[model samples]
Each structure stands twice: as structure tokens, then as C-alpha cells.
Target: MQTFTLNDGNKIPAIGFGTFQIPSDGSTYKAVSAALKLGYRHIDTAVAYFNEGEVGQAVRDSGIPRDEIWVTSKLWLQDYGEEPAKKAIDLSLKKLGLDYVDLYLIHQPYGDVPGAWRAMEAAKQAGKIKSIGVSNMTPKIWQQFVPQFDTLPSVNQVEFNPYFQQTALRQILAKNDVKLEAWAPLGQGNQDLFKEPILNGLAEKYNKNVGQIILRFENQEGIIVFPKSVHEARIKSNLDIFDFELTADEVAQIRTLDTGKGMHDPDAPGVGDMLLSGVRFDNVAQKDSQKSNR
Candidate 1:
């Protein structure tokens, strides 16, 4: 797998298997186990996803060396204080049945963000996490948060795709030497993204599907992409982009598809409150929360 170098000198695979919205039933474990077996070394999950334990189960069952697989989980908004966020890290490790994860992120930009990030930096220093970063913290939020923290974020994950490319944010991240991870690189099943003429033409030229073309664009742009799917065929197909390359002209043409917009802009008014209000988790993480309080 191709890799991106983080500011902290660690390397992350360019492509990963995203486990968001994977059902909490046994399916999550089974799909994750299948993903590992199907050549995916990186698995992205979160406390909010309510499936870290399942992800750990799959990793253990696969018999892959712990170092061979990269597991990532996030700090939910509700767990954003320094002390609670520190507890959250230990809690996530216990749930994953691992000593450390390859990455841990502040999932959203709301709540005690600086406190949450301080906890993450401490974890990184203590070796509980190999790298730390933020998610959905768009440029506007980056301006507000980066100045407050001493450690630079290793990455900033956001909604990235052909139709809603973040041109300005990419430049900012580039200047700061932070990696960009794309959560919905295939545009989260938006039919319009798949129907774009430029993407379709690239797909035909490369003899790959539209999804491959889109994901390949991310590879060329040096962005990490975590596209999710339970289908065995799709899982393997998503990783088959190293053999081909997109020309500068072709890449530029795709860049033009950018409308300079995406969902969940942290700068937008009311987005923070909206996200904070909407976050809900009632599985093991929440049960553990009650125990902590008691």
C-alpha cells in the first residue's frame, strides 16, 4: 500500500478501510475480519461508531501481527476534556484489546477541543498512540485551534471528493505540512459524483470504475482515503490504483470539478451546536461512561 508521511515522521497507508455505519451486530466483526484478510491493513473506527471492540476482535482473529494493522479510533465530543479524554484513550485501548493504536483523533471540533487535543498529544508522547490529529476541523476551525496547541496536528480529515473539493483548505494544510484524510472520497454514494463526465472519462481511460478513478485522484493528490464497503469485490477493487497514474492535465481537469464547498463546515454558524446536539452513542462506550461517573 502507498503511504503518506506524517509531520511526526510516521507513515500512514494512503488507503484504508473505513468502518463507519457498519452495523453493531456481529456483521462489524465479520466485515472487519474479511477486510483484514482481503489485504486492508488500516481500519478506521471510532468510539462514536460503537464498534471498536468488534474491530479489535477481527484484528485478533486475523492473526495479523498487531504492528501490521493500523487501528484508529476517535475522541467523541462528549469526551473532550483533558482528564476525561485521557480516560477515553485508556478506555478505547481496553476495548480494542491492544496496547496502542496507530492513530487517535479528536473526532469533531466542538466541546473542550484544546483539552481534548492536549490529551491526544500526551498520549502520543506516552506511546499509547503513534500519531494524533483532528477530523472535520475545517480551515476556519484550524485557524482557531492550531494557535492554541503546541503540537501541530499530524492530519486533518474532512469531506473530500470531486464534486466538493476543498481547494483553500488543501493549500492551508499543504503550507502547514499536515496530511489530509478524506472520509467520503467516493462522495458518500452521491450519484452525482459517479455521474460526472470528467470522472467517467477518466474511468474509461484507466479501464477502472468511477470509484477507482475518484480514489486514484486522492492518491495522486496525496490525500488519505478511507472508502467503506462490505462487498468483497469492492473491498479489493478499491485498493487497485497503484498500477495506473493520472496525468497532470487529467488531474487538473478533475480539480476544476471542485466547487469549493463540503458539508459540516466548522466555520459555518450553528454547525458546532448542531453537531454536538446530534452526537448519540448508547453502546459499550456509553455504558463505560456511566461506570466512570459512578
Candidate 2:
């Protein structure tokens, strides 16, 4: 697996197994176990995913050395305050059955981001996390948010794909030396993307599927991509992107598909409220909160 060096000097695998919508009913564990067996060293999960424990269990059972794998989780908006964020970190660690995560991110741009980031910075200093970053932040939000902190974010994971390429955001992130991680890199499996002439042409030229061609395009752009799937064949094929390379012109051809806009707006009305209302602190975190109230 190819690795990208973060601004913080930590190396992260370019391709990972994303566990966002994977159900926790033992399916997450089975899928994760299969991913590990298939040679995926990086795993991305979040507190909001409600499957961190299952992911942890899979990792423990994989028999892979703990350090050989990279585990990433996020701090939800409900745990945005410094103290709550600290407790949330501990809770995530306890559930993961690990001392520290490879990466911890501010899951969204809302809430007390500074306070949460301060907690993350302290965690990095204390060796509780190897790196820290944010997700779904727009270029405007990033410009304002980054200046308020002493520590730079190692990455900005956003919704990026061939159609919505985020050119302005990439330029800013590049200028700040922050790596861009693509969350919905396959456009949420949109079939229209599969029919694109540019991507189709490239897929034919490379003798790979449209999905692989798209992933390879992002990989060549130095963007970290983690396409999620519970199916074993798709999971296995997702990692088989390192064998080929696209020439500069061919890469530019892929770039022509950019629409300069993403499907979801992070700043849309009710987005923050909707996300906040869905907060579900695990039993461990809830107990910690109750104790603190005593």
C-alpha cells in the first residue's frame, strides 16, 4: 500500500477500509476481519458509526500486530467541549481496546471546534493519537479555523470525487501542506459516474473497472481514498490500485469531469442541528458524563 506523509510527519496508508454505514450486528466485525486478511492496514471509523467496538474486536482477532494497523476514529459534536472531548477520547480508546488511535478527527465543522481541537492537540502531545485532522470543512471554514490554532491539521477529509473535485479547497489545502482525504471518493456508487466517457475511456485504457480508474485518479493526485464496501470482492479490488499509473495528460482528462461542486453542503441549514440531534454517546461515555455531574 502506498502511504502519504502528513504535515505532522506521520505516514498514513493511501487506501483504507472505511466503516461508516456498516451495521454493527457482527457484520462489521466479519467485514473488517476480511479486510485485514485481504491486507488492508488502515481502518477508518467514527463514534457516530456505532461500530467502533466491533471494529476493535476484529482488529484484536486479526492477529496482526497492533502497530502494523492504523485505526482512526472521530470526536462527535456532542463531545466538542474540552472536558467532554477528553472523556470521549478515553471512551473511544476503551472501546477500541487500544491505547491510542492512529488518527483522531473533528468529525464536523460545528460545535466548539477550538475546544475539541485543544483536546486533540493535548492527546497528540500525550501520545494518545498519532495525528489529528478535520472532516467536511469547506475552504472558507478551513481558512478561518486553521489560523486559530498553533498546530496544523494533518488532513481534511471531505466529499470528493471525479464530478465534485473541490479544486479551490485542494489548492488551499495544498498551500497549507495539509493532505486531502476523500470520503465519498466513488460518488456514493453513483452509476452516472460509471458511464462517464472520460472515466470509461481511462478504464478501458488501464484495463481496470471504472471504480478502480477513479480511485487510481485520486491516488495519483496524492489524495487519500477509502471506498467502503461489505462485499469481499469489491473490498479486495479496492486495494488493487497500486499496480498502474496514469500519465499526466490522462490524469488531466479525468480532471475535466470536475463539476466544481459537491452534492452535500456542510453549511446547509439544519445540517448542524440534524447532526447534533443524532448524537449517541456510548454507555461508557454516558457513565463518565453522569459521574462528572455528581
- Tens digits of per-residue lDDT, candidate 2, 143-218, equal 7677888799999999999999999898998887999999999999889998998888878887899999999999
Each candidate structure's count of clashing pairs: 0, 0
Model 1: per-residue Cα lDDT over 1-294, one tens digit each: 678889999989889999999976777888888888888899999998888888887888898899888888898887888998998898888778788999999998887999999999999889999999999977778898889998998898899998778888889999978999999898889898899999999999889999999999988999899899988889889988889999999999999988877754667888789877874654568564343233
Lowest lDDT sum, 10 consecutive residues, model 2, at 285-294
Model 1 stretches astray by more than 4 angstroms: 278-283, 286-294
- The true-versus-predicted C-alpha distance at residue 158 of model 2, in Å, is 0.4
lDDT values for all models? 0.87, 0.89
Ten-residue region with minimum lDDT total, candidate 1: 285-294
What does the lDDT come to for candidate 1?
0.87
